[model samples]
Target: MSARTFLRIAVSNTLVKNIARYVMMMLLALLLFGIILLATGKDPFQSYRDMFGATFGSAYGFSEVLVAMIPMLITALAVALPSRVGLINVGGEGQLYIGAAFATWGALTFKDQPAWVLLPLMALLGMIGGALWAFIPGYLKSIGLVNETITTLLMNSIAPKIVGFLIFGFWHSPMDTVKTENFVSAARLPTFFNTRVHLGFVIALVLLALFWIIMKYTRWGLEMRAIGGNPQAARRNGIPLKGYLIVIMCLGGAIAGLAGMSHVSGFYGVLILNFSMGLGFMGFLICWLAGGDPIGIFLMSFVVAIITTGGNFLQLTQGLPYAVINILLALALFVVLASPKFFEGKKA
Candidate 1:
């Protein structure tokens, strides 16, 4: 092809356009955050250098980023699946907590079982816990009794408290009142590369692949998409809209539960009081930014993981508050939200 034709072809490629948009949005977010740092009399250049250096410049640092990414990837999928059917599942937080709680219970109960049996049992318990918690809102939304968003959000607050109650009153370790005893080896997920990275990483990747495959090729996925695009039309054509909404929400919760299970079993090795630190909400933000695309979720989750993992470097080396990471993330999200306009302007 001629040079001009090649250039036009590259620009017209959807993947290329999306990549360009994402890169520009990221740069804009970084630039805005740098200005904020400069306004606060900090050396933004040094801070930026430190951020990348601490997270992406070392093998251990990169591994830690992967560690941070696992739960966010899974939880983001939790939100993404429901969004496919036009269901807003804001209960990932609750689902995660409940899942952890259930997994913890299994760990304690099956302490003497072999790894083969115990690990799967714990994972199942976690999914059941999360799915059960999600069902309340799903059922309500299906019946038109309450909006899923409101019920799920409200349940998020309640779920943690229930977990707290369980821990304080029943499951506390003998030494640590705020956490359970360490999980037995049988109950823990296996790790690889002598790092904290565990089976959960593989699970996340498989889930992402499955998500992509199902959405691209499955009849159920087609109907779900139709429902999302036009619920009334879908219903008229015989799609079971209410059933899909309920089932999909539960599936999302199950995935979020797996995230919780991996967290407690593979990462923490014990359920600590209030250990989540807004992972569900962070996943929600990631899902929103990625527009429910599996590939987008993976990439955006990594970016978020970098920001979160680098937060400690900023606090210790740059003397910036840890909360600075949240501000940076917020700026990135805002930039993404405004990116459609940016693209529109480019077209104009």
Candidate 2:
């Protein structure tokens, strides 16, 4: 085949594979919902229908779901980039928090600056802070002294404590609550409406476009994809493995940092204990489930977000346990895990 033909074929194959994977995921979700109904002795069809309808039935619910998806898009990008370069970035939570804390600091300290300067500065500093935060593990891995996962996870533990110290020791807002500090007006992001949605969603969308383009068209992306397919072969083919790893780690940190800014500047507008919470891990889950497909990231993030929103709705309206909704999602993940080869055989 000609090079153009090969490229077309590859793209065609990828589209088919992605579609098959999503179909299997949906089928698995149905099966699990049925199993849940059987186990709980509840009407599975009704429960499933209510759960799904709760996510999509109202404008408020739909908006809430999309708002929740914003962070995952950012974090998924962070995880997916490093993932493509064959590196695991477990430090996204830590990187995100630290970036938020520092961005909050910058926003407060530079209160006199205009938005044009302050916004870019905060984002840049956030990116730098997160990159440095993840760099330790990346450096250690590059030099052959330690595994990145352990080090990255350790950093995750360390991040909240550092934030705690800042809240208690310094940077504490005058509010009676000692647990979190509020950010100033210039520090917080402007919302799209009276709703909690922020410009960060747009930021994430732009990032999705950028990442997709990079992965699809760039030489660096080609190298990363080749390396991800098989590092040993990539190394043999003259890809600088360590350099790519460092790049991946740093970019991953920047992506996480962007997520951090979204929280501080958009959601909470404060430095709080474990503020980032499960978002980073959630992003990784999206990345894993989507296999670095940008469009898939966009769709699956919203789907997961809808489930989360619906879970909250169930809690508020039906007195359903939050744990039950989580269990449903977990079951879905398990189903996907149990059938890795389910999507591989699709030819179209």
TM-score of each: 0.93, 0.86
Give candidate 1 misplaced runs (Cα > 4 Å): 1-12, 340-348
Model 2, which residues run further than 4 Å from truth? Answer: 1-24, 27-50, 177-179, 229-239, 342-348
| Highest TM-score model number | 1
For residues 1-348, write the lDDT of model 1, one tens digit per residue: 489986885578776777888889889989999999999999989998999999889988899999999999999999999998888888899999999999999999979999999999999999999999999999999999999999999999999899999999999999988999999988999998888999999999999999988987899889988988888999999999889889998999999999999999999999999999899998898887788888788889998888888888999998877988898888888888876443232110
What is candidate 2's TM-score against the reference?
0.86
The per-model lDDT (C-alpha) reads: 0.90, 0.79
lDDT of predicted model 2: 0.79
lDDT for each residue of candidate 2 in 2-58, tens digit (9 for 90 to 100): 899878966897678866777677677867767875786666666666667776776
Pairs of residues clashing in candidate 2 = 189-265
Backbone Cα, N, C clashes tallied per candidate: 0, 1
